[model samples]
Target chain A: MDLVFFKIALALYLGASAGYLVFLLISSESRASVGFWCAVMGFVAHTLSIMHRAIFSGFFPLATSFDALSAFAWLLVGIFLLVRYHDPSPIFGSIVTPMASVLMIFGWTLVYQVTEPLIPVLRSTWLPVHVTLALAGNGVFAFMAIGGLMYLFQERLIKTKRLGRLHRLLPSLATLDTINRHGLPFGFFLLTLGIITGAFWASSVWGSYWTWDPKETWTLITWFVYAGMIHQRMVLGWRGKRAAVLAIIGFGLVMFSFVGVNALLGGHHAFQGANRFMPPSGL
Target chain B: MEIMVIGLNHSTAPVEIRERITFPGDHDGAVARMIGDVEGVEEAIVLSTCNRAEIVVTTKDVEESRERLIRTIGEIHGQDPSVFRSYLYVRHGADAVRHVFRVAASLDSMVLGEPQILGQVKEGYRRATKARTTGPILNRLMHRAFFTAKRVRTETGVGSAAVSVAYVAVELARKILGELRDKSILLVGAGEMAELAARHLNNQVDRPIVVVNRTYENACILAEELQGLPIRMEQLEQRLVQTDVVITSTGSCDPIIGKAMMKRVMRARRHCPIFLIDIAIPRDVEPDANEIDGVYLYNIDDLQAVVAENIGERRKEALSGERIVSEETEKFMHWTKTLDAAPTIVALKEKLEHIRATELARLNGKFADLDPAQREALESVTRQIINKIAHDPIVFLKRTGAHGKQNLYLDAVQRIFRLNGAADNQNEGEEL
Candidate 1:
């Protein structure tokens, strides 16, 4: 029941993302209502599956890093769909939905390798709080990247005067810039909190507060890039175009470090009990 | 008081006059200061961008304020006030308010749906607020304009497609290369158009920008502004091999980077594609340079074709943007209309409350000696009468006044009971 609901939820999120992308290109008003409702349904399904898994296993469901990542992406999609209701610019999902899909897909790929026992190492009271915050931060940064890319693209199209068929559906560089402006601070705050809680968890386990691990370094770099982008935007009066591009680029860096580093690199941040990298018994 | 707007926008004024009077910053602080000094101007804001200079003011008499404002703005541009009198437009009452809302929402921008106007409006309001001249009335209108601007952006496709010629140049490069960060862009001349194309490259990636110009100083200046490095025109041959893109717009009679140099470039770069944009009129680079392998050259005519295609999309978004403005404006006007009646309604309600309470007090002592049951029943009957009396008149005032028929209805209610009696002491609720 748990796996079935999880698969259904994943399919819905991917479908919603594709639906929103189509709506962005053709931009019918009706498509927006469809995308928003689909995302909402997916979120409900995701939450149910996670709860069912937790109850069946008799723990808070922090057993595997991949499972936690999957849950977080689902949460991000839910939050993203809600925010999109308020500002349904196609560029938003252009940056956001990809992050949700990518994280879930990566986690799903490791389904066989990941281990999730409801033991003491994964049973800290702050486990849910820490994981939720980190994923929320990821969601926010993903938006910044999208807003930035749109800014750069919009600036170019305006200069070239070659705006084509789907061009009319894009958000204004100024509007994207504003979303980036507000989105950065929110993303920064969440990532900062996530880092702090992760540090607390680390101390309780690893007995060290600061380690220069790949995950730690990359997340910090992501933080600093956004921090710089926000400062350039607010205090310097960077306004629309420049600010937007910076946001998109910043989010790209975040994704590269998040999915690429975790899935490809066999660093300390990889799933603790990952068997995927191990050689096959016969081979 | 009437809402008054008088100034020249991109449609009415040229860039020279706009440049002179633009409140791009508190840059000169000239336009902002002059608007405040105009007589009968209670609250004011100045919105000046490359395309327009507009002054939105809350005033007692728009005609007088209009004349004064144009004169002051014209003076700032060192023109005789009468010369620009023909170009300046004057909108008053609801029209003036609607204009500001539309302009701030970017429905009136030169590009139709460009989004910078909202930030520009915010900057103007911020400056006015700093000067302490922008109070509640201007604040409310300005804030409503901002809300409308946001709605236009999200709910409508006001600024969707790339419209301007300069932006089109940059977008084309992206489509060809996938990403521009690591690519090399070479500017062939020292012209402003070349500099503009470079600015569009921006800080998307960590790649360096190279500018090769005939004049070292011009290249240096542009390079400094864009944080790029300058290379001399002598290196044109060598640079072409390394450069991925070349943009040329110059006044020179002959081609700067011709077919010979471009052919050499194609072979050296190993058939790596390059984009050549010629914006100059007499043709800076030769047209046949495109015949060479891996050279994707676009002249002004090709660009215009793309611009023509963009027009239909821009036009479509323009209609969508306009629809958004009309809907948002109606919603805002509804609020203002209701607000216009609220003060008098409050005063009328207060008068009724005072009379009802006094009559209740008089009856209170008279009924004190009666039985408790009898007093309670009488009080309930009196409360019901007060409700019935207040209901019909209040409902009548709200319904009639909101639909542009407030004058007679307001007078009738005021005369019947001499209610809102102090209305004569101040200006009537109708804005001039």
Candidate 2:
């Protein structure tokens, strides 16, 4: 039933992505509304799916890679909807829905039965709190990266004076810069809290306060990147294109920490244990 | 009645000729009323702008009205008819309607997609309304013209882009800064184009403008005229820190603001974005300054290039606007066709006949006990009454149609009888 709801959410998100893609081309208000409502519906179904998974698993459902990715996408969409409610610009939707849809697709492809009981190490109260904070922080950083990309696009168009249609369609550079300015410190703050909580959970479970695990090291690296960006932005007033580029680079670090660390380096948080639920030698 | 537009615009007349026949201020209404009093003209609206002078009217005889209108306009302005007659262009009927729509949409403007013409036309229509010179036909036509103009404005990018260098600078500022309400603007030196751009920016932002020049006295003079503060050129780098937009048009031999100085200024400004518009021939700001992180330097040529590109975009958008105007003109003409006596008279008869047949059929049961002769007499008497009731209106419509006053009577009959149904209601709303 959780899988069914997840698939429905995925389909709705795909529909929203398609709608937003069309909106980017023609820029019709009705098309944006279609995309917005699709995203709203997708968000609803995704919430139900997440709730169903939590109730069935008897814990917060971030044990598997699929659960973690789906939650990340859900948080991103939620943040997007909240921002859209205030700004009401469809341009962000054109960037956001496709990203969320891709995340949903990645999660859907890795879907597997969660018949095995929760792992001994994962069954802890701090599991939900740490993962939720980290994923929420990632979601915010993703939005900042989107804003950065838009800023560079708008800035280039302005600098080159080839304003064509997209220049008129996108938000101004200042607005995009503001997005980065506000998102940086908040995302960095959340990541800091997430790392601290993970340390506390690790101390309680593994009898150690710190570990040189690959995920831990990568998270620290990503945290340091955002930390530097925030310092530059606030102290030196590094903004506009420079700030946008740093934001994108910082999010790149975040992606590597969130996915690459666990996939490539066999860390303590690696999904190899969760992949045992997969059927052996089957399609 | 036939609608006609007789006008001389920039294309057909020189400024001298246009100036000679312009009816300024209070003279517009008087001129319109005078034209309304002409022998064949039933309604009149005189639109006199700097670029064009036109008389829009409804009349019985197009040729007689046009000839008398030309002579009367010349007489009002104390110019000979022969002096300006060759410059005037006339359009009648559907062509006249299309011309009004095109003018309102700014497609027929000297600068394509210029916005002032619509407001000018609206003011002319308002004056004609105040003078009580415009009747139902002209009123409806003016309203439809305003609607077409609005559709063209919202549906196309015809007037969205800036065409002048000064306005393009303002537009680019808005694009980069998002809002200019609090952004400070600096004037580096005194020049006509620089002052024009500054004044344009001054209207949008609330911040007081600052003027700096090599000659402090000139800066003070220009600043006083623009209602701003004057500063010495020695403080150029200091002022650059606080300025969000700078318009420099100095007659300097070399760059006034160099990349090195601009880089220091950017550091002092904490890398906040700044726009520099150099309208000078030799360029007051170094071209390399544009490479700075937050500096957007647009020289005179660059601004001109942007203006050229925008004008081209507007022209392309004007094609779509023209399509809207022609489509609306066709729709308006179709509605006018419904006002013709032939259709209204036929529709009136059909409506009355249908009513009579329905009433007679509804009372058929009551007359069933009577003989066939009684029923036949009932039907004939009802038909006769319907004909008698419809006779006066049908004749009135026909007579007015011949005399070129058919629109008023036909519209009245159509409304009182609701003959045109849903389409008529929709058109009535559109005219309003």
Query: Looking at candidate 1, what is the lDDT of residue A28?
Result: 53
Best by lDDT: 2
Kindly report which residue stretches of model 2 are placed more than 4 angstroms away from their true locations once superposed.
A1-90, A104-136, A193-217, A256-283, B25-30, B348-405, B413-432
Native contact fraction of candidate 2?
A: 0.51
Against the reference, the lDDT scores of all candidates come to 0.68, 0.85
lDDT digits (tens) for residues B1-432 of candidate 2: 689999899999998898887876544477788889988999999998888889899987898888888888888888889998899999999999999999999999989888899999999998888888998788888988999998888677788778898888887898899889999999998888898999999999998999999999998998899999999989999999999999999999999999999999998999889999999988888898988888888988988987888889889888888999999899888777787778888898999999888887888788779887977888789889999998887777777756756677878888888876735645656654
Task: Point to the candidate with the largest TM-score.
Answer: 2
lDDT of 1 by residue, B278-313 (tens): 877789777778766446678777777786667666
Q: What is the lDDT of residue B300 in candidate 1?
A: 72
Residue-level error in angstroms, candidate 2, position B256: 3.1
The alpha-carbon RMSD values of the candidates against the true structure, listed in the order shown, are 13.2, 5.2
Task: Kindly give the stretch of ten consecutive residues in candidate 2 chain B with the minimal lDDT sum.
Answer: B422-431
Candidate that scores best on DockQ: 2
